[model samples]
Every structure is written in C-alpha cells, then in structure tokens.
Target: MSAWVFDLGNSRLKCAPLGEDGRPGDVLAFAHDGRALDAGWERALPMRIEAAHVASVAAPALRVALLEALSARCARIGLASTQRAWGGVRIAYAAPERLGVDRFLAMLAAHSRGGAWLVVGVGTALTIDLVDADGRHHGGRIAPSPALMREALHARATQLPPVGGHYREFATDTDDALASGCTGAALALVTCSGEAAAQLCGRPVPVLLHGGGADALRPHLPDAVHAPALVLEGLGCWAQVGRTP
Candidate 1:
C-alpha cells in the first residue's frame, strides 16, 4: 500500500507517496503565498491515498486547512511532533516541544545516515542542530535566513528590491550585495557550526543541508550534503515506528 507524506513550510508545501520500502517516491513541490494555496494543490494530490503523514511548520490555520482537505482522501493521517527522543536521537531540549518539528525530524534523518552530523535547515529561517555519533543532540541555533533578512530590509527601505540578482563575493551592485550578504551569513554560521561539531566529536562532522532556501546557500557549503527531502524522510521514519495509532 502507498502512504503520502507532506512537509508544510512557511513558503512551500512538499508531498510525496511513501513506497513499501519506507522511502518516499517522487516529490511534488507547491509554492504558496502566506495567505493562499495554489489551485494545483487540489489537482496534484491523488484522489485516494492509504495514509498521510505530515510535518508542518506553517501557521495553524494553514495546517487546519490542509488537514481538512486531506481528510476526505486519506484513510489515516499522522502529524509529527517535536519529541525528546525518536529514532535513537535524544534531544538536548529541556522542553522538547519548544523545538521545532522540522529541526527534530531533520536530526532524526541525519541519525539514519550514521556517524556525527551537523544538520542545517535553510528556509524562511536558518536552523542548525548538531548530533554526535551517539545520537545525543547538542542543541542548535535559529536565525532569520538570508532571504528573510533581505525581505525585512526591503520592507523597511523600499528602495531595496526584495528579489533580484545573485551572490558575489565582492558585489559591485546593490542586488548582488544583498544576495551575497544574506547567503554569506548563512554560510558563516554553517561553517562555524561544522568546525565546532568536528572539534567536539574529534572528527570531521559531515554536514547535511535541507529546505527551500538551501539552494541559495549550497554553493558556499562545499562539505554539506543537500537532502531536500530530509524532513519527509524523517516523517517516513516516524511512520515506521509504531506511532500510527
């Protein structure tokens, strides 16, 4: 039987069918404004799915709307939550629920890859979580991702275009400067975190990067593995544990 997995972020919704092997099939990405989903949201999903697993970091109203829409087609629906421990990864959070589910699942997915790892998620926000070889979480940091930072700046000073151009180490123009500055901040954080993780674990820490904004940051992160479906993979891992009750 097939199961569907959905990862709802602030700016996008990604879904894929879970195969019998517990791996997700071809992914479908839908771009959404903060307020409304695209018309393709209805047509993109299958008419009937055996099960639906979701990990959402979107607004509550969006969550409710997506769930309500899926209710008609799915035989069962499971929502992933931030937990103290799962799939051998022990969270460092004193209050586990305070940790975002996206971060938790990303760690879970990293653990499955084996060895010490630094997980960085680049979306509306940049989030980094470190886990050692033993699967103990060492906590993480959250910052406005470069994209958000640019958007905020433009909101304050309308002269700055919110979207345009690309990254340059030494930008000669306004658009490139914005791109370089934002992406550079994310790169600096990831590289520094990777260095720290390596020192703590006494070996090089492989970095795993994911999320919508990952592409913008990837060129600078030569050591990182870009796993776009990381959270969805973790959702599949979540489905494997007997949590489907």
Candidate 2:
C-alpha cells in the first residue's frame, strides 16, 4: 500500500512516500520557519496518496498547515504522539505527554533494532535519550545544539557571528573557537550522556544518532549508528502498530 510520512521540525519539513517494502522511499525536504513553507514545496508531493502519517514538533499553526495540505492529497491521515508504551519500549516519564514525541519516536526506532541504546537527536536542539536492551526508556536530556549555542552567543554578543569556524581540539582563532567550543560542548554532553546510559544498562550501549545537526555532531561521535530517517522510520512503525490517542 502506498503511504506518506511527514516529519515536521522547527526549521524544516521532510516527507517521503512509504514504499511497498513498508519503509519510506526517497525523501523530500523543504526549509520552513514556524510559519513559512518554501516555495514550490507543495509541488514536490504526489498528487494523491493512500495514507499520510505525521510526526510533528513544529508550531501548532505550521502543523496545521502541513497536515491540511496533506489531507487534501491523502485518503487517511495519522498524527503520532508520545505513547506510554510503544514497540516494546516503555516510556520512563511519569507524564508521558510531557516528553517530546520526537524523542519518543527516536526511541522507537532504536528499539526496533532490539538492543540497549542511547538515542541522540541533534537538530534545532540536542536531545539525548536512553533506552535499555529490554525496551525501557530510562530518561534523557535536552541542551542547546551546536547551532543553537552559536545562535545564543550571536544574539547576546553582536561581535560574534552566528556561523563559521571549524572544530579544533584547541582553537586559536575566534571563528575556530566559536565552532570548537559549541561543537565540543555538544560532543562532551553526548559523551557524558553515553557513559550515564551505559552505566544504567550495565554495559556499552549502541548510540543511534539522527537529526539535521547530526552530521556536525557525528564526526566527533564515531561510534554512533547513522540513521538519517529515524523519526520517519518511527512514523512508519506507528503506522503499522500504533493507534492515535
């Protein structure tokens, strides 16, 4: 059956047709603000689809906009939300709704592989979640992503540019310093979180990393499993087994 999966984040929108193989096929990405969709983005989607599934953390308005657009082209639509338990993974949060669906979905994707894991999503924000071999969500952390860190600094310090520089072990120049410091900060956190997750699970856990900023974070994190379509993969999981709340 033909379906579609949409993952709408704070800064971008990604969608793909669900292949007969039960996985998302080619991805279509579009730059988006909380309110704006890129020009011709709508044209990229197929004229009609059998079903559409969404994993959205964009503003409510943006969520509405995209889902509405999809509704016109799809016969049925599904919105995925954080569940108390999903695909063998039991959420750790006392109030599951309080946890971001993106994190929950990432955990689902990781658990699909059937092992203990530290799921790290580096996007507009850096989200680190821990799930064990037995499918227990131990919890996670949230911090400024490297880009967000740079943006925070730029917003406060006009002299500092938000973009540029390289990651150096010991940066000597300002540009390198900003890049190094920001990237290093995130890397350090991922390391610390990984260690913590390992301790909880009683061994080294595999790290499943995904998100927009993941490429920048991945170089420093050599051990992480690169799963670019993680959230979309989770959306596919939900489509197969999850029911809307």
Q: How would you encode candidate 1's per-residue C-alpha lDDT over 171-242 as one tens digit per residue?
A: 999999998888888888988998888888898888899988889888888778999999999888888874
Question: Over the stretch 39-145, how does candidate 2's per-residue lDDT look in tens digits?
Answer: 77988877888899998899999999888888888899999999999878899999999999889888888888888888999999999999888889998899999
Task: Show the lowest summed lDDT stretch of 10 residues, model 2.
Answer: 236-245
Task: Tell me the spans in candidate 1 whose CA falls farther than 4 Å from its real position.
Answer: 243-245
Model 1 TM-score?
0.95
Candidate 2 global lDDT = 0.88
Candidate 2 segments exceeding 4 Å error: 243-245
| Cα lDDT, model 1, residue 165 | 75
For all predicted structures, in order, the TM-scores are: 0.95, 0.96
